[model samples]
Target: MSGPVRSATTPSNPTDASDPPTSLNPILRGFNPDPTICVVLASGGTPTIFFLSTSTFEYFPGCAIYTSTDLLNRELIGHALKRRSQIELRTVKPGADSWASTLRYRPDEGRWYLANCLFQRYRPASDQRIFPRGFYVFTDNIWDDNAWSDPVYFGDPGFDQDLFWDDDGKVYLSTTTRLSDRAPDSTQKDLAIHISQMNICTGRTLTPPVVIRRSPHGIAEGSHIIGRNRIYHLFTAGGGTEAGHQGPDAPAMLLRRQTSFFQSLEVTMEFSTQQRGA
Candidate 1:
């Protein structure tokens, strides 16, 4: 880190306090930093990994997908579902079709999904103003070359989506609320997560948006569910990067765990951290 070196891991509440020592490094921490992943159970009960990647260019901020077998290692699969396509930067303006990214996965339905937070502009025919909205996308196979389903709008004007699903066939999605006229220099707005039902079969969003969590420090949104038997756990990040100190507010990747009938963030902590920038 370039700034004052600051680092921590679930400081107050240590989940696995009694666990013994081990030497296995994190299997999947390559070019991707914040990962929202899902394990696809293939035929004969095999699990595959698929995740979302962020913007690589100016007008091509599309979500890239990847696949991994060993969990720690992976390969860039292809583009996220079509709904999250890049916004065309046509005008003399710098950016064309830019795309923001969001994601979720459904194993029972054998599909992986993503949402387009990639916001761009458009002047409607009647001179009506409308900021581009977010949408959803899905695929059948995670590891192999698969195609994304049609895009479906999930938010009015939003991006940065967080999603999760449980063992009992329950589904949830959390996302940031998009404010049309956010202050330019007012700093980054807090990221939000919304909960809803996702149809496991057709790969469709099935419920109204429900607010789960919001943070001014910005939400990393790479959420995963971990627990055994009856005990349930939710892992999330909370912290910002060091480079964006004075420019755009870089919030910490806040980590939080949840349980209790889909209510309560129960536990708040960190999994990985970067207190400063090099």
Candidate 2:
């Protein structure tokens, strides 16, 4: 279910070399953001793709799901959170309900898992305060509207949290953490990518957070882990998402680890622009 970082390049024109090419139209319109997709293989060897997009600060139904068999056409399936017990957002701000989310399927368990980060200022109906919290839900059947389980809150690993299930039945959660919080004046880096063993069933951390990679260009977020060719690939989007920003120089970076996932040795890949100062 893991793959390489998606390309942002627009295709070249098929008619003429001098003419500009068009990009694929948006499959899901509206305010959906931070989309995470997973491909599921059925018993008959058919591939079913599922997509989950962030519905930040939206109503009761937070994250939206879409299903596609051909990858080109997608159909609106259902929302993950339907009941108020799943997510209570009446007291939350307009744009602070939920953030980037990831959809993952566990073959052994025959279930689908959805992990998302919730941005809340304070605890509901209490003076106690809490930072951002990440939570996950699972469903035995993705096609059913009421199949998803209740939200299981986990620790705050910041935004764009991802779930990676290894071949050995170990589950890991990867996200961006602030290095400045530990060392404010440290010039080595400001943000770092951290990973920790997670008990997906109970939403608990099995080990302490381990710093796998530090951002060299800018703040790292939107992290995802994939294993291919016996190597674990950690892909992240760095810099900023704004236009004319540091992100242009290096919008994405990839790190590869062999033998062990705890090793800090990394190979950073910088994105290259096709043209400059045109």
Pick by TM-score: which candidate is best?
Answer: 2
Using lDDT, give the best candidate's number.
2
Q: What is the C-alpha lDDT of each candidate?
A: 0.47, 0.69
Q: Can you tell me which runs of candidate 2 are displaced by over 4 Å? A: 1-27, 45-47, 122-130, 180-182, 185-189, 244-250, 275-278
User: Compared with the true structure, what per-residue lDDT tens digits does model 2 show for residues 203-264?
Assistant: 78888888776665646677888885557777676664545234544455566657667777
Q: What TM-score does prediction 1 earn?
A: 0.55
Which 10-residue window of candidate 1 scores lowest in summed lDDT?
A: 1-10
In model 1, the runs with Cα more than 4 Å from the true position are: 1-34, 41-61, 81-105, 121-132, 142-146, 155-157, 167-170, 178-191, 196-210, 216-262, 268-278
Task: State the RMSD for candidate 1.
Answer: 9.4
